[model samples]
Target: MTKRDNASQSKQFSIYLRSTNEWIPVTKEQYKEHSKFYGSFRKKKQDHCKCTCPHQKWWFCNADCETCKYRTGGDTVSFDFMYFNAETAGITPLEFLESNVNDFTIDVDNKLISIEIIHYIQDVAPFILSVASMRLKGLTDTEIAKKLGMPRTTLLARVNKTADLIREKFPDYNV
Candidate 1:
């Protein structure tokens, strides 16, 4: 079969094997059976965790609270604080991991400044915040433009505008 035909066939008949982390061709009946099993497993897992913290929901919880690294300690902050910081900063914890910021301080004082800046951007132009987040995810200008369905030049212009706004608003701090 041609490459396009193979691609179409795979899309039609493939089942992802979670254990092997790969997709394999399967009969329609087999795919249906697997989907039923997987759906139940997902629902069960979603309701497994019983933690009270808002950040400790089933999907995001590690399920080992006794030895969790985020537990209160000498230098570690609580998971709730970390979640709040990331939320206020307008990014996910995973996005913070992908960031270039060296000092990962979890205290409120340090995060407050960033949170203020993010809130300002969010208030002024929410689109810039989305574009900035995509940029933070290591997307190139071309890729960001394509994903946002805008021209490359328009994306560049928006980026420049955001920088200018930041510089104007927070002159003491470098952008």
Candidate 2:
């Protein structure tokens, strides 16, 4: 694989949550807990592909491309991506873990908010809110869980649950 392929590998943990249909960043530790595929990331014959389908700058294809067999896409093709979720984080995961409970809302309409929506919400569980904030800052799940004095998987669950809440309450926010 080339540099771009390596970049894609780096983005594996970068998940697109079921709540928001956009790419969301997650900690490497969280990826390990929720998804168990990174350690097994070895080179394989079917690791890549080049399709001749109609697409623009990487918009969604009609489910007919075979560039890779990542989970984001179907078995018929090989393109994949990630998305993420949840409460508005005013402070940060590190801060929350350190006993800081500042809840700040990232404006729903802010253009940059879409990059990480969890940091821009209001009213949510403290743990989940902290997890989202830490994720926005690009910390791995393991790191957050460790600092917050919780198990890795537990943190993952909290983050996912928060994402579900966001999806249910603000479907129009495009978070």
Candidate 3:
């Protein structure tokens, strides 16, 4: 390949620099240098949670430490580390399902929906409840419309109507 072709190809292999908050193209040599720098920096920055857990030997807190009922709040760790550690631990499907339930209200962007409001929606407009449930499960408008056998526009209209109903009935909700 020509030099220009090689440069373009190298552009496809890019690495993100967290410190710089940028994704930069890397040639093989540059990639090796960056990898070495990152690896050494990571090694130098190695830290362990200072929690009182007996199994605090790990570099980072593990699932066992997190789940231990006796765990007192220790040194606050970065959110990224906690998220990755949780991913490594792996939650059961039952745990995932149970976590979604809230006793009273579902809060989204400061808007609250109480259990009574949910029951009101079920009694007055059952379809709205279904749409809301599907939306909560991370379904897009198009996907929900397809599943409900309705047009995209109709789905949008229903969503708006549901919002309007909530606002009208529970003005304090600010939906």
Candidate 4:
């Protein structure tokens, strides 16, 4: 698929929490961990009728117009694009994760562990210092993982943990 298609491969989670009556924007990772899922619902096959369909943008025919029934005096077709977990919907995944005392969060909580994670990023700073360094030099994540003799999964976890540390350290900085 194209770049746009690849971009859309990732899903966004927008939550309307019933208890708080608030809209919470969550990250993609959060969506994966704490929710039932659905989607990648690209519109396919149009109708052949002459009636105008709202899904024309998806290139459907007139017969496919039923799918866009709002134009046909029907109430708009409300699709559950993603899984609706009435139970989970009332609470956010991040809040759920935070409630559980997971290893990742606990590691992040300890000052020594936090410093170690921060150091990993900082230690790599010089390696990333040059303007062209990011573009030109050295190992990719996979390569670095191999060189450091760590599993790719471990490396990724470390990197993710480091990034979380940065965010926690400077919430208002918008890193």
Q: What's the TM-score of every candidate structure?
A: 0.37, 0.30, 0.35, 0.25
Off by over 4 Å in 4: 1-138
Local distance difference test, each candidate = 0.65, 0.54, 0.62, 0.50
List runs of model 1 lying over 4 Å from the truth.
1-107
- Segments in model 3 whose C-alpha atoms lie over 4 Å from true places: 1-113
Which of the numbered candidates is closest to the native, going by highest TM-score?
Answer: 1
User: 3 or 4, which is superior by TM-score?
Assistant: 3
Q: Show how many residue pairs clash in every candidate, following the order shown.
A: 0, 14, 0, 10
lDDT of 2 by residue, 1-175 (tens): 8999899677755554433457666888775554444222321212433333222322222232333333232234312322223553454445454453322333433545454454434456656766668989999999999999999998888778877877776687755
lDDT of 4: 0.50
Tens digit of lDDT per residue, candidate 3, span 1-175?
8999988665655566444557778787877776676444333333433344333422222233445443554455433342325454755545544566552235552344577687778877788878878989999989999999999999898778877887888886555
Query: Each model's RMSD to truth, in Å?
Result: 23.2, 28.8, 21.5, 25.3
150 Cα displacement, candidate 2 (Å): 1.0
Of the candidates numbered 1 and 2, which has the greater lDDT value? 1
- Candidates ranked by TM-score: 1, 3, 2, 4
> On a 0 to 1 TM-score scale, where does candidate 3 land against the true structure?
0.35
